[model samples]
Target chain A: MDTATKPQQIRLSTTPSRADLEALKIGDIVYLDGLIYTAREGVYKKVIEEGADLPLDLPAESAVNFHCSPAATVNPDGSFNMGAVTATASFRFSKWIGPWIERSGARIIIGKGGMTSKDYREHFVPNGAVYLTTVGYGTGALLGRGIKQVKAVHWNKELGLAQAMWVIEAANMGPFIVDGDLAGNSLFERENARIAANLDKVYEGTRPAVLRRFGETDDRTDEVIG
Target chain B: MIAIETIQETAERLMEKAAIEIPEDYLDGLRTMANTEDGDLSSFVLQAMLENYEAAKQDRRAMCGDTGCPRWYVKMGNEARIEGGPIALEAALRRATAKSTNEIPLRPNRVHPLWRTDHDNNVGIGAPEIEYGFEPDGEWIDLVTVHKGGLFGTDYRMLFPSDGVEGIKRFFLDSLVAFGKRGLACQPAIIGIGLGGSKDTCMVLGKRAACLRTVGSRNSDARIAAMEDEFKALGNSIGMGAMGFVGKSMVVDCNIEVGYCHTGGMQMSVHAFCLSSRRAVARIHGDGRVEYRTDPDWFTDYQRRESVEWTPPQSLSKSA
Candidate 1:
């Protein structure tokens, strides 16, 4: 918590500290005070789906990437809660949280759920970025802290909360684990990469789940998984 | 003389009045929690509810547009009499539907999945309730037309890394996981379960469950009441908060509708929102008349320079 002697710089370097990362354990709490970028389904996919580059210039350095699409709320106690759900559907559109974390000059990937990608690790280790986990269903609690403000840019009204860059300021948030880490020996990264390497084999070229019940479409199940 | 009530009249009445909002008791409880929850994240989740209330009021939009599949449940009074209903309730309702659709612009959400999408209409097979009977109670025929909307991202079966609950609890956890993966769009989402009913009935109720309700409200059944409490607490433990980011994200509300099950008919649906969720309901007399509430306050306006954001501009701790 040193403030003046050697203030923690919101580093923008492509590489993070390996020593700082390996020193961490599974449940070790961290208060990351730095530059982080938030994006959800629409913004995440438009990067590749639309074959576009990073929305505002990519900063794959010490930046952090948060995968979330928050709704606005005002608590009775006068606090604010934002980002109260899961980012899986956005994941359905694009699994860019990891890649963007790397490309956005971020060394931190934060959100609920798990990510399994080798490229993510390859990038994470050299850059010293790590994946952190927030509780799976505690979304409402996350937002209850009362949002001070969500500094958002590059918004898509049509996409609503789906595609946008949000700067979230959290309060008293804790215990979000490092699901994936830059130690290069993380469990999350290894499995994700293995899956990605053979996604085409496992899912690609597969027929669409046309005969789904409730008379729904299988447009997503058959999409080209990245 | 068939003095037809112009469809326009019916719609305005419905929008302005008939749509049934969740019971007062439900919202009041949520207000209490939003005010009292000591948990920081708990307060944030509650705030989302406040926003919903404001949005539905000011804009006059369906509080949550999954305004649901409109199911007309009719209860006739013992002395209930028909004036000129030679105009089928279904037809009258259809006319009202068309008017409501245009006015609220409730996204042309309905489409026959089996065929090409056509929302040029609102009535479909067995829609607006062609099925009904006399209650013989003269109970003033309180017509409960409930609208349930789509609240899912993936099927419960589609929840990956199979979880560890069994029986109803398994069902509940599966719902949470499915809700996380599919129900919620990675945002603050309310999960409502239809405990028992026909495939159609449960689905309708399930949608309504998320329509609008005060948090902490419960069913009369002891089992369900307990289940609601457990599901909510357990869900929060999952740390899927507002936008499913992470925190003590509270499920603002979860409603369960139960009816006699008919052959493998149990359904659960989750209507998730990144925040600006809009859903509301009202009631009308058999005459299609209603006494709607006066204009209330509007929701927090969407600033041109602002929108829903998962992360903040500064560390939330700045104020903490």
Candidate 2:
């Protein structure tokens, strides 16, 4: 690796401004500060589908929403024990992301395995939000250390620990890579294109399976996720 | 007789170790990849993972928040006896699983598939699957716990003998490319390939090959071992690295396991044990001695025996 080309790292607020996001390139490393909250399918379904009011102020409280399920537990005394924090795949949440961003006024969506550029163009670019991916698909323990405190957990009884909304105070919490940018450019798609250029040569001697499955694509450029 | 209390205690410790510690084999493998990896972003991700493991151990936290599904692989010597028997042994394992989930602060990942019920503990119906195997001699039981990330980077296919190894290679490449994009499979992982076996067993064999086997280990058969080397190289040549970046560190190692399947079918499954690659092992002797190690040392000669009638190896017979 070229040391000269080392990714530039920056720190930004959880409630980042439009300029803060616009200056971010697709591969810049980002560390976050201020408040962030966890929400996934359960929280999305609750607020967007079931028509329940959000338990807290949206972008006013925290513009960042983490697609995460921490290795956490609530003690008998009711305090939270958050050990490791990592993101789930963001592509799975495409259905509700646009609506959630619209409703919450989020500027940053952080998770693993970023959504497609189409997703970025449709949901995020219009909403003035960007996608940041957790490095290594995670650096859970490191991320855990960045969490200054667990401020609150909502709907633990109703949605369960993995699905509940967790409000947290963060201090330089990251190692996240900017996967989506203001222009809706995707780092992953760029990498995929580069990788796809060689698939033909690499796959030379092999033949497809004798049996075929429904909806399987032979196109190497296509993504498994929508 | 092996005490059930000892089994429970040992299991709990194994759980913590699996969650927090990066086994030496996997660590060494990753270090090698790190040294060779040249893609800037991919290299950075590898470096971050190296530090993550250290932080996990130093702070006594799980390496990955998605701690994967906790499972048990118990192997007993034919002569081994438990104080309270198999039923008691299972209860002990389950108790340890639930207790350690809370103690280690593991994400309670298991839930009811259909209704989406969460126990808040990893324990649920058939959650931490316990599989069994036996050796011909001795009075000791080996307990292995593997916390394998359950999603992505695994696939199965049915092919006929006519399709041959070429077909196998195609499926292998397809799986790697599909899941390797954006690092969904959590690449530069140990790739396990299972060829032959009934469909379900193919999946099991591939998973065990990924989770149970250590890096650099190869199949016992000479031909299969050769294929393992070829597959590892083939996967790396795909020009993808950690996080699906442009690089050549895709596969740390490839392990292939095979079983007899129906003559008409060649069932294949591919599994990738992610960057965390969490597995821990311990053996408990009847007289109360315990030893712990990272390598499960699964797939012994006896486990892969090809004959209908079992025969003790000459060395084993002489020792007996």
Candidate 1, residue A36: CA error in Å? 22
lDDT of 2 at A122: 96
Each model's lDDT comes to: 0.43, 0.93
> Which 10-residue window in model 2 chain B sums to the lowest lDDT?
B311-320
Q: Identify the runs in model 2 with alpha carbons over 4 angstroms from their true place.
A: B316-320
Residue-by-residue lDDT tens digits, candidate 2, A33-73: 99999999999999999999998898998999999999999
Whose lDDT is greatest here?
2
RMSD, candidate 1, Å: 15.4
How does each model score on TM-score?
0.48, 0.98
Q: Which portions of model 1 miss their true places by more than 4 Å?
A: A1-92, A95-226, B1-11, B16-26, B36-49, B61-71, B83-87, B114-116, B120-136, B153-166, B181-191, B195-237, B253-289, B292-320
Q: Encode model 2's per-residue lDDT on B164-225: one tens digit a residue.
A: 99999999999999999999999889999998999999999999899889999989799999
Q: What DockQ class does candidate 2 belong to?
A: high
* A105-155: candidate 1 lDDT, tens digit per residue: 666666654444454455666666676654323323233232345444454
Error of 2 at A118 (Å): 0.9
